[model samples]
Target: MKHLNTFNNTILYDFMELFHSLPYTFLGMEKSKDAFESAKVVLLPVPYDGTQYPYKGAANGARAIIEASRHIETFDDELNLELEDLGIYTLDELEISLESALETIKRVQEAVEEILDNKKMPIILGGEHSISLGAVRAINAKMENVSVLQLDAHADLRNEFKGCKYAHTCVMRRINEISHYVGVGIRSMSKEEKEFIEENELDIYGTNFNSNEILEKLKDKVYITIDLDVFDPSIIPSVGNPEPQGLFWIEILELLKKIAQEKEIIGFDIVELSPNSNKISDIYAAKLICKILSFSFFSKF
Candidate 1:
């Protein structure tokens, strides 16, 4: 691994403490991307999970994930590179009051638009899958040449979930309206989603297909989003929407690496972690987010 060490070879716990003390700050320097107004990568945290049925902790998912990121080393052994040096800006959590899901999406859309207008790559920390509707819509409006990669266990292609068209169950269906999306790790689906999948011929699937194969089939640029429920409920049970079976960390990393190698990821997000005092789950979410940024932005830069 090509670790360009900037910090001293300090203790891991000390490093975690440093990262935890200021969860969102870059390098313990009270650093803000405000200085680099033209930063390429932007991290947006949306901690609202207003409509999550039976699960309430996803509302705190963004904060918990950010907190856990402190212990993450800058270097990624798999990618053989260091992160953080690439100038990925972490935005303070967006103000999402007790608003309707539709309203929250509008708010998220505006926030993502501001970041994208500056030509920055947005890595959104989602409150729910619905938040993606706004971000994807804005990105679609700005750039017509991009594709969406929806990662989750559920198809999320239903026309509506219960009475809400904007439920997590329909998030990808919403994405279908804005962009050509390819879904991976979809093991669950509503009837409407099944109908839509069959009618529209969506690439929603259950197995870990070859990333290179998928990449070759896709266009050159992509927007990657992950709803943590994509992993099996066994390993990552702390999600708002838990599923029966799913992908492992290495499997996910491999696909992400291939995407980074083969395409330009215009934007991305990791959402739906619903931690319940399980420190490992929160830490896992945080470290995974850090690892993703490392492979997708930091390591490459």
Candidate 2:
């Protein structure tokens, strides 16, 4: 058994060398193909799930999304463009200890601030919805009047949940404190959140609401935060919380395309994918990320 293990390691080493001489990045991109210094887009993996509830494994979301991206075709059919030339850099995953959610937010904020400082568009892959808080906070510091467009099953408007102000359940509430946002696919939330949304007269579109109407409310510069559970559970069941009668694949793409054409998507994050043994949801998440990136690339040039 020991000899067989050694042989396997040797073969793996040889294969890696033959395939890639540099560190791993999204889409299995070698260092030369997507150097950080020249890349227009950056993929930042935040694999921290300190505030998740009802499901655990969301901390592995970034790893699954990156692995699944390896299979994405470089050519985008919808836009009739090849996005590979744009230089997509996948930074090493953020080093996170199992700390309090506040500490995690600080770490993510610092990393995102650096990415913004470099003048690159940051695409964050999340461990949970709470991670978006840090990215949003960082972006808000740099860009004025930043509005968040949230795609999720829940409003996530709790001031605090499970005694943690930075809990995944309260992410949007924290975000709202800093910047204005519009919520879509919000079919689930507590009474308090519902009241909060109503009291504030927030611009939120329900699951059955028109997707196109979101365009009118969004600001010139928008940051998109997608929680995978916004999709019907039949298609993306491996999320932190699954809600039925959610948005479909095509509808989401159409909305994103429209937004890309009209609004400047400064940064975005896809979070809350609690991947199971099945690769189905992971692949879906990766494809969604790729589509958004493609649309974003087209918007720029």
Candidate 3:
């Protein structure tokens, strides 16, 4: 009996070591049986931040988020559920095209289309906000009556920026051409974007807007695009363009829960997480993703 106990302990240690050494997955959980086929949610990491200018480290955001995710506990105390049960599968980081921003976006669109075809929900970890354009395009192609819910500090309504239509600043402009969108948490924008918003009579809500009013503007099917800069810089200062006076943690979570109950979240992306020396920002972003997933899919569980 003593020999058997020693052998079992040795095996357990080996198994734990192997698990920890494996390639990082979201929440550091073991893959489920037939991970891709059985997974209700798939994480598509696009580590291409070619369009980001002025601040350029956002290309490293996706990997940082994945690495930080390994440290998070899988159990959600608030929801009283295990997040690992959701079968979240993380795909290899997408190979980015250095040729041009448009080519990269095209690749993103193709990747997202395949995920949608498989009947899996895609949670894209973006290199920058521009990647959301591809995911939105893919979603719009397959589903009708889709509206984009953008949570960001910038309106991103510019027709072009730095001679690139697909630049991170112009992502929502490209998306607006494809589908209707509503912007929230907007406290920064150029005069061009402001004029465009007025000219188009767009639905953009600022920091003080009512959540219920915003909900009324959304359609039955929603594709959410979250730029980490939407959060207050004091809470998450590791974004490409951190702005002051942003949304707090609880407020964002509460709104997400309300949306989860009210509408269908087709897919979502969390972008512009330029990781710095602050490890807390990385962990916070990882936790935010898990919480959003928990709220989005809590009904299925």
Evaluation by lDDT, superior candidate among 1 and 3: 3
List ranges where model 2 is wrong by over 4 Å.
Answer: 1-23, 32-34
Give the top-scoring candidate (TM-score): 3
- lDDT of each residue in 1-301, candidate 1, tens digit only: 2353433445666877776665454332235546457456677889888878776778788777776676566566876665655666678888886857888888888998988888887878867788888899889778867888888888877777668888766788788887898888888876776887998888776755777667866778888889988876777778887878688878887888788777878888888888787767777777676666666674445
Where is model 3 poorest over a 10-residue stretch in terms of lDDT? Answer: 28-37
The lDDT per prediction is 0.76, 0.87, 0.89
| C-alpha RMSD of each candidate structure in angstroms | 8.0, 3.6, 4.9
Error of 3 at 16 (Å): 8.2
Error of 2 at 45 (Å): 0.6
| Top-down lDDT ranking | 3, 2, 1
lDDT of 3 by residue, 1-301 (tens): 9999999999999988887564588877566558777888889999988988898888889999999999879889988878878888898899889878888888889989999999999889989999999999899888998889999999988898888899999988899898999998999999989999999999998788888998899999889999999999999999999999999998888888888889988889999999989988899899998888888888877
- Alpha carbon lDDT of residue 135, candidate 3? 94
Model 2, range 37-67, lDDT digits (tens) per residue?
7888889998989888877889999999888
TM-score of 3: 0.92
Model 2: lDDT of residue 134: 91
For all predicted structures, in order, the TM-scores are 0.86, 0.92, 0.92
